[model samples]
Target: MVSRPHGGRLVRRVLPRDRLEDILRDSRGLHQLDVDDTIYRDLENIGYGVYSPLTGFLDSVELESVLLTMRLSNDLPWTIPIVLDIDEEARRSIGIGDTVLLRYGGQPVGLLMVEEVYRYDKRLYAEKVFKTTDPAHPGVARVMSMGDYLVGGSVEYIPMVRDGYEDYFLTPMETRVLFRERGWETVVAFQTRNVPHLGHEYVQKTALTFVDGLFINPVIGRKKRGDFRDEVILEAYKTLINRFYPRGSVVMSIVRYAMRYAGPREAIHHAVMRKNFGATHFIVGRDHAGVGNYYGRYEAQEIFSEFPDLGITPLFFREFFYCRGCGGMSNEKICPHDRDLRIYISGTRIRESLSRGVVPPGEMMRREVAETILSFENPFVE
Candidate 1:
């Protein structure tokens, strides 16, 4: 059976339509806090139960707990801290116990019942969450750019119209319903950011063989340079699933959360999210969510040992390669071929080749998927 939500219940704070007028009317003449797309995405996810059990942004206590223990104040396993940062001026102007409306692009996205506003040490936050304070690291760089103070409180999520990619947007509740309809009690979720290659397919299909369904939940939002554009990633997957995956065995959905390349911590965060989406199992392959050499190749898999009670069964897979001896995809767990005889399917190498207009060999990525990617004038995020 699919596991219970991370905190025993899904958190859906989406403001009901009938109550919208009253909320909007009441929000006026209060403190207005302008938020960007990233914060809006957080609100949307929390409202949709993607970050279940988190009714709103984390307060000082919750933030400190997550940073120090990789869990919430209640001791639930929550790796990443979901917070709303504001400038010093707003921190002073928007006081504790005040009601503030979070606006993006002049639209009311949510309301925050002001509970506490506090400052955090950026360097420490970077070091704790990402294991590095190097400014070059994308996750660290994000921390460096955050505001002076953090806002916290329970949120009344106001759903905003997320234009484009409407077809792939599925809330946690919606996906759970879909899984139930498909009789998928043992769904294995594969979290991804890059376009699919054969090695990814190998791990996903391998996991699928042991589960009732495969959930390809790709994170779509702000990304680092050279990563596939959000649209390209979605299109490439559509081609792959439609052409290769067995009908009724796979479901492709997009999670509109910003990527935090926290490696091990992010791996746990991803698993928690998939668990909330009703996944009974999650796949954590080599270097899952790692960037550069910030984390060891197996660190993401190893960190799962710290949380035996995380609730979702994590399926760890070693790096896969095309073994000339086996004549097919094989990993260290099963392959007997020497390293010299194997052609490793590396996402970085594939991306470099594609950026230069080269379609990789069918052994690495299928021609259909390759062609779909190459169709874009520039597929990488610029």
Candidate 2:
């Protein structure tokens, strides 16, 4: 049986197709709020049901609840607050019950029916959500740098902007239909921001062995310095799938959402998002969605135990490395090799090698993927 969507139904907030033009025409008179790429991505996901059960940006009450309890006011589990933040100038121009035009890159994209406009304590928000006030952590830094005022309301978006990778961008509804058509009742989703390593391949393929299909959904959004570019990740996965994977068993899609890198909480967030996308299971590997040394290696996996009815199973995998004794890629639980014979290549090592125009060892990354990384001009320079 297919997995049920979280909250029992997919929350699609986009205006109906026939009413879109009329809505756009009526939105011209509304106050306009120019948003950044992150908000734009949030709006797109909200409209498309990727962030299901969320009709709009979080209100003050909901945001507070999420920060304190990782649950919305309705008691649904939602770790991160998807609030439409704005500067004081923008906040002052809008009021309760006002409709605001949401624009991106100077072009109108949507309209937000402002319900609540409130100021937030940035440091407190950062500390609560990310469990730290240290600006060095990327998630905390992002929260600190965001606008002080947040606008809360339902959104009516125009058709999302298709920026070159339209074919790879599939909404939750579309993915559901695709899976049904392909006769894949049980689908496992593997979320990643990095390019595929052998460990990733192992996790995905292993997950596929039990499920009817595998969805390799890469997050194609703003990434930190030295991380693989969106295009590189797409091309590398394409190469890996085309050359190695069984046909019709796997599908690759791009999820355009900014990474919060909130460690264990973010893992639950990811699983919930995939659950909305018709996934029966989600891969939660070592340090999934973690950054730096803030979280324990298996903390992401452990978080799954807190929410038993998440509507999706979290497939946990221990640290994967190539063992000369096993003579193949193996996890710590399966490989009985000593540390001396294990060839462990961290993402840091692979990135450094790629930055210096060297391909990572074949045992760590596929030759095709490594060669693709080498073909790019200064892959990590950005």
Candidate 3:
């Protein structure tokens, strides 16, 4: 059977449809705060049980504990803090024991029962979560741009944020049911924010050899510039799986959460999320969820050692590259090829080639996937 959700039970915080009207009517008297896209994604995860064991945004005490030790106040293995930041005016207007309607795109999506309103040190948060205080880092930049005050409270969802990919979005509960229906007792999840390359394919296929099902759960949230758009990613994966992967062996779904690029910590977060989705194993490859050189390439794989009973096994992989000596894609541990025989394609090279209207080599990405990527006019122009 698939593993239990992280921290035991799956949390379901969304109220029944019949009861939402009554809650909305009562919430009219409470303050309302419009959240940004990032905060909205966080709320969606919390309410949908993607971030189970977390009923709401973290209060100051929980936030501090997470930042300092990568654990929640309850000492569970939580890497990043789920916080709802607000401007000074909203902070002044809302206080402990008050209720606030959390809106996204000018629509009431949930209600936050306020528990704490506090200020945090952004630099400290950046350094603690991302191991950097430099604003050039996208994760750090996002941290620096956040509002000074954070509002913590349990959330009640009225309408979950779907972001136009509702058909591909599946909550943890839904995914577990799907796995059960497929008779997949052992499911391995592969997390991605980019279009699949040959290296990624290698990882997935490698995991498939051991598991009954492969779950491709891509992050469908706000990404940095030059990253593939959500639609492009979904379509590319569809093409990849339909043409290459065996039918009934793979499943694709969207996990709506902004990338934190917190490297090792983010890997933990990813594994925990997959565990919640009933995955018995998770793939942690080189620089998983990493952006730049801020983290060592293999740090994400190494981080899993810190959490012994994470309940989900981490399938660690080294950097995969085309080895001309072996005439196939191979990693350092298996291939004895020298540097001269190893062919590696960096994401920058692929992006540059795509921008120049050139398809990346089949060695790096499948020709079908590359053509799908090129179908868009400068797919990474954003």
Best by lDDT: 1
Clashing pairs in 1: none
lDDT, candidate 2, 1-382, per-residue tens? 6677778888787767677667667766779888888889889889888888888999999999998888888888888889888888787788999978788887777879899998999987888778788899988988888888988889977665667888898889998999999999999999888888998898888889999999999888776677788888888899999998999999899898878888899899999989888999999988888888888999889978878767788898887889999999888898887999998868888888778888788889988899987787756526
State candidate 1's TM-score.
0.95
RMSD per candidate (Å) reads 1.6, 1.8, 1.7
* Selected candidate, larger lDDT, 1 vs 2: 1
lDDT, candidates in the order shown: 0.90, 0.86, 0.88
Question: How many residue pairs collide in each prediction?
Answer: 0, 0, 0
TM-scores of the candidates in the order shown: 0.95, 0.95, 0.95
For model 1, residues 253-342, the per-residue Cα lDDT tens digits are 988887788999999999999999999999998888988899999999999999999999999999888999999999999998799989
Model 3: per-residue Cα lDDT at residue 348: 77
Clashing pairs in 3: none
Runs of candidate 1 with Cα error greater than 4 angstroms are: none
TM-score of predicted structure 2: 0.95
